[model samples]
Target: MNKGLYFWKTSRIPGKKQGIILAVLLAIILGSVSGWYYLVYIPHKKHDEEIQKKKADVANKIKKIDDFYEGQLKGGGIEQFTQLLNEIYQSRMILGLTSYDEKLITCKPDSCTFGYEILKSHVFNVQKKIFWGKEYSASFSNKGINFSGIPSNLKDNTTLTNYRKKRDVAAVDCGRLLNYIYAFNSISDKSDQIIIAKPPASSVLDVESEVKSQKKSYGLLFSTWSMNAKNDPIHIMSIFERQAFKESFIIKGMELKSKALKITGSFVCKSGK
Candidate 1:
């Protein structure tokens, strides 16, 4: 009986050491899983959400472009209307273009013009104004061209309340404004001349306002546009101004001013044109 007891003790499997090793392995696996969830899976989920949001935003912008054309056809067409279409075509090209030198591309001619004329008739006015010892060609930067023109008193206005909202407006406004500027710039480039102009002072008004109390004069419309470039994405920007006043609106000769505009990103274009 004693010999049997001694054999049993000697044969007892090394269960204590094996159990300890198994427990340690299980603990390690649980810790690794927890770390993966916190460091990788959660962040990946958040990144996907952000991407979806941006895609939605791009989709909405495309819809707005389509709607504008629909409305243009519904509205009657005059020579001015033709001019507007050309402007939009050019503007759209400028939308994807990334250059301060104004090399416009990425638009079909017809659509840009449609948008251009409508945008142009409402947003710019040229008047003689004294600023820093000179009379300059001036129009208002569209309310959409950032809050640069927003009066300090109106900083809290519904539109000027936030940078993101203002930036969005700038993008849209840039698209619309580029239409006219592109046409003009195209001509200027072909002729090898550069035209300098400035945004109108706060006081510029629609001449039609004086003719009839009930009728409203044309006003500036601001819009935003963005580019989806594979490498360097750009937000081509400009503010559109419309002045439907008499043809004598260009009385004030062109002047140049050096007010700094805030730019947030990069753009690439083919040429200086």
Candidate 2:
């Protein structure tokens, strides 16, 4: 009886050992799964979050570019175009388009050779407005705004036989206007304080030329300036008229009545944005 009992105990010991081995294997499998959840699963989730953030940033940049082009296409007349130009100018200024540092020095000193290329492009762009965009003729800059491009309602008005004379005057006026206003040094030297403080009159800034070709009427714009220039301290006078229509005029109460009307109507600055 004792011998039989010893054999049974020995067999039970081996079975108990097998059970312990199985328990150890089960614990390892659970630990591996938990580790995967923490390391692999959580890390992948974070990577997805980062990717989403990058996509959002790209979307915002694209939206801004789209809005800019849309505004350009709308033309919204000269005032709107000028306003857009001013915004771009201001952004470039803030971004240090001409320079790299906070000193506000031009790109020349900063070795940013790209500045020349950008400025050249911008100058040409603005000049195009003066030449062809809308209301004021290319001659307005030269021959005065009163010059008529098409002389008469007469069918055979061959008076344009001297088209050369007309063209010459238009060219001269355009050149003179550009010479007075398009000086790079002069523009750069002009105080930013003035640009920020004073804007031009509503009419000048928001100008429209009503062109009546037969029964159809269309509004066009040639050029636009900063309405803020209206309040500038600098005395600017048109070369042809010699009338101080900008900063000086406002200081002298020339626009008192207009100002009153604007204020009474709760006039909001259109280009404030």
Candidate 3:
């Protein structure tokens, strides 16, 4: 007999046995496929979904950061602050008031250099014949420019007395002036007081030299002299004193007069940080 023909004949099985064997093999394969789908594929699919959700969260956070930076760029950043300073300076110039030179202005994150000027006065005057007023004196406290002056011998001249009363009232009502002074000083560096000569006693020429000088520094002046009043010549003598300060200035340990007047002014220019 031939070898190949003998092996083929032995390998053949009966019909019923062959069908049963095939069915058992098919069942095993189907069970294995079902197990793989439930145990491996399902878990892997869920993990992939979680990863995608995390990626979406990260993307949203990055977008928010980008939007914030974009908004800052559109707001003009430091340029807006600089423009505010310029407007303030222009307003001062229009009012015939002194202001810091534009070229000299400097800004930082928390503070800026915008020039300021303050004029504070203490005046005492006496007239001999027309108004024989007794010695008058006034002093101010650190609390906020209070004026307390004593005037005497006003019973004979009601006009002079009335004028003196009016002057006194005006002097004490310096709330506006004090507001500006305190506002500027609060933002300044009170380094030193600048001293300059007092202006002339004449009404017309008094502030001429002082304004022209433009000292650009802070100073205080005290002077006393006898000068004829503009219209009256009753041999008047007056003592006048003034305290002035420039921008970026500070007062040495000065307190506010009342709690009602809070310091509300702020710098117009600031750094973009």
TM-score for each candidate, following the candidate numbering: 0.28, 0.30, 0.28
lDDT of 1 by residue, 1-273 (tens): 999999888777677778999999999999999999999999999999999986776555444443432222122112222333244334335432422121222222121101111133353323332222333332333321211111111112212222214232111232333444456456532222123233322121233233224322222222221212121112111111232211111111111113121111111111111
What is the Cα-based lDDT of residue 227 in candidate 3?
Answer: 17
Model 2 C-alpha lDDT per residue in residues 1-273, reported as the tens digit of each score:
999999999979989999999999999999999999998999999999999986775565445433432222221222222232343244334433433211111111011111112233332221111112233222222211121231111111111222212221111122333344445325443422122222222332221212122111111112223222221112222221232111111110111122110000001112222
Lowest lDDT sum, 10 consecutive residues, model 2, at: 259-268
lDDT of 2 at 10: 91
- lDDT for model 3, on a 0 to 1 scale? 0.30
- Candidate 1 or 3, higher lDDT? 1
Return the TM-score for candidate 1, rounded to 2 decimals: 0.28
In order, the Cα lDDT scores of the candidates are 0.30, 0.29, 0.30
What is the lDDT ranking, best to worst? Answer: 1, 3, 2
RMSD of each: 22.2, 24.8, 26.3
Give residue 181's lDDT in candidate 3 (0 to 100). Answer: 45
Cα lDDT tens digits, model 3, 142-183, are: 322211221111122221232234321111112333454456
Candidate 3 weakest ten by summed lDDT: 231-240
Task: Candidate 2: give the clashing pairs.
Answer: 134-221, 135-221, 141-173, 142-173, 198-228, 199-227, 199-228, 199-230, 200-227, 200-228
